[model samples]
Target: MRDLVRKYKDFLAVKGVTFDVPEGEIFGFLGPNGAGKSTTIQILATLLKPTEGTAVVNGFDIRNEPDKVRQSIGLVFQDPSLDERLTARENLYFHAMLYNVETTIMKKRMAEVLEMVELADRQKDQVKTFSGGMRRRLEIARGLVHYPKVLFLDEPTVGLDPQTRKRIWEYIHYLRDKEGLTIFLTTHYMDEAENCQRIAVIDHGEIVALDTPENLKSVIGGDVIKISTDNNEEVLPVIKNRLQVKAEKQGDYIAIQVEKGEIFIPRLAVELKGRINSMVIKKPSLDDVFLHLTGREIREEGVNAVDRMRVYSKRKH
Candidate 1:
């Protein structure tokens, strides 16, 4: 997407965001709730039109060739969209019909996808009888029924358990490595973002940072030293003045960012020996990278007014 913009009356939900995803790579949009990740995906999937700018998906321009764009992309919605009354196979068949998969190979394609997600055994069962994870897997299978070039997974494992989430990611990787499908996903889970070859961190409708996870974390430039003490208020300034390093109170610990935390730790231990309660050293993580860029931690939030407006507008449109 180049210079993509989306407006909801006075609120700008997506601000001139621009990026490209290499074919067959797992590309992630990482951010907290209401960060325009979904909006940008919707525009690319041809579910919503951008107010300005355009993107080409699978060799088709999103604006001028929406039908072709839709044909080339598969979508797994953030929310469940399966027909509970339909059987697993029925769901896949319905989706295949929508995408106009040739009748001669529809059943073969359905079986292939069902097996890919390990849901072949339960294909005849009603969707209502399936577990959350099972249903999610079925949804994924349904999305692939027509063999699209790109798959858009909007928070594919949002509410699944850790084990289930892991299994889902396994399937995602298999899709990329085995099927050679370009995977575009939006997520708030830092670990999930790590799975992507590249990530675009968005907040409040703008792309704040985009890079490989390793590269993004390198921006922190060193290890993180977290110190816990009884008198945080007194020790905070002392450490800042003594070491002349960046130190701030993060909850119960004073987080210090510096190069070579191991070298810094012993000197710190000696200087604050009597007062220090505990100390922990760790490498920088995606969470730290996000905090460093946004000046805040990612937190769950309800749908913002702009998101609500976008939804209502989508329905109206």
Candidate 2:
């Protein structure tokens, strides 16, 4: 966790970030690539001491009591950490040994975790032979081999297919409900964050908002109004003062966060009748919240959408 913190902060990436993950809650860390989500997680997981602020996990300061914080949490990193050469069972066994689980409990617990993740059949197979999903499940099992009280999943389901991603979502709930483990997850996936008890949204290294999914959605006015238009250089400020909420210009669409789009739609329809070719109204999404806060798309500048989608994929989102 601490190592990850430093990796992201060496260039002074984070700024005035502060939040807490309550016990027994599935807390989400939401942000784009350079939003400082990873940097904060590294500190919380005891991987890196913050260059400034400090995080305390399980009552121990992340900077001064790193070992205590480490003891209380399990971390599954953004990058693949599993050994391709090792079989799933071997991987769990190795981690179990490192954690000093009692001999009698190690075998039983290993079996339990493997079965829980539905990787029991593949326990004997080398990770390299497994598909992307299999390796991820095995990595999750390994993270749980020691049964730490809190588990940090960084972009938990990155490369898996839809079905696999859904399976992993169920597993995350299982960790919280059955195993009594508090799951700390950082993801771009709106669906995944919906499952969290609480969520903190960060942008540009600052936490923009924190609340349950419903509460967060409730903050936005009403239905979302999306317009097809351009010349953001011309329309943005006008819309901002008119709407009193965020107006994001993407390609030809200007998405506005409003309380009552039913009324705003018609009024806005007339206001920009010729400016925009068309408009639509729908429910708000995490994308809207993110846009409201940062005024930028999830895969903002420099990060290619397909490449970001393909590499981080379901893992973050």
Best candidate according to lDDT? 1
Best by TM-score: 1
Reference-based lDDT, each prediction: 0.89, 0.78
Candidate 2 local lDDT, residue 241: 80
Q: Where does the lowest 10-residue lDDT sum fall in candidate 2?
A: 1-10
TM-score, every prediction: 0.89, 0.84
Instruction: Kindly list the per-residue Cα lDDT of model 1 for residues 1-317, writing each as its tens digit.
Output: 99999999978899999989989999999988888989999999999999999999998999999999999999999999999999999999998998888998998998899988889999889999999999999999888988889999999988899998999899889999998999999999987899999999998789999999999999998998888998999999999999888887766888888999989988888778788888888998887788788765564446664565455446654
Q: What value does the lDDT take at residue 14 in candidate 1?
A: 99
Question: Which residue runs of candidate 2 sit more than 4 Å off their true CA positions?
Answer: 1-10, 229-246, 267-279, 301-317
